[model samples]
Target: MQILTPFKTITVSLFVLFFLTACSNEEATEQTNNTPVAIESGDECHLCGMVIAEFPGPKGELFEGRKSHVRKFCSTRDLMSWYLQPENRPNTKEIYVHDMSRSDWNSPSDEHMINAREAWFVAGSSMKGAMGPTLASFAQKDAAEKFVTKHGGTVLEFKAITMEILNTGSAMNMGSMHH
Candidate 1:
């Protein structure tokens, strides 16, 4: 058997390295694709077609799959509505919502978006979102409790949110009744 010359050895090693790097980059790109995308000016709600940027309160972004385009929502309510559907639940890759504790209720910032699964939500607050009554998302439980004390909402975890709360419009009316 003939041994490879130094030049040939170098070329083969470089080719292998290049191929490995390309594979690694592709994986990184896939992961990055799941990261939250900032809502644009003209971005419309995936469910209602409302102009997302024009609305106040926390917004949502959903990554359905590794290659799917993010589904944007004007309010966290809309995001939950979509996610609660039987067909969408199994396919969900990622869900993001603004941390209202770190964002303005009237103009949520993209930099404050957090993993929705880990967020605390205040429902039935006095605050109105894109869809009228909306769930105010927070990153911490204490922040949620503080908001409830001030805004008149019940603090709930992600799984605690239900379709009944969304459909009845009671979340919007909850704290308002006391006043």
Candidate 2:
């Protein structure tokens, strides 16, 4: 019989482990792709940037994947508008635009607030010559009240700011997003 060296055994084990890990990852990814991911309450909508509330029952659109009006355009009309005029849409990836329930802009996840919109901003904050829309969103109401109080700005529902309004870089000037 041929003798196997310790180094060879360890190498074999490592290769098996690596192969198993890769397969597991692929399986998980495949399962995710098979089904539409439901947008959860805390997650920001792809279109409106509004945060879904835990008790915001029977409102907004609910697509097969739980898509909604404020979150994903609210309607086929909005979605088509977005697709046709891509430039008009805000950087859905960079900007979030959450409703503020409180003014702190500090601890956002507090339960005291019921439902508020917030804009989670990061990318456009540094854009030059007129920064793009910057935001973070929330589903807590009290949070919105508190946010406007300290930040000193108007509080608007998710529908207030449309893709057109946001594209002008106007909301960026709507007082402070500071908490």
Best by lDDT: 1
Per-residue lDDT of 45-141 in model 2, one digit per residue for the tens?
A: 3455555333221112222221222333222222323533555344322112222333233323223222212322121222221122333333554
lDDT of each: 0.90, 0.37
TM values, all candidates:
0.78, 0.28
Question: What local lDDT score does residue 79 receive in model 2, on the 0 to 100 scale?
Answer: 33
Error of model 2, residue 148, in angstroms: 0.7
RMSD of 1: 5.8
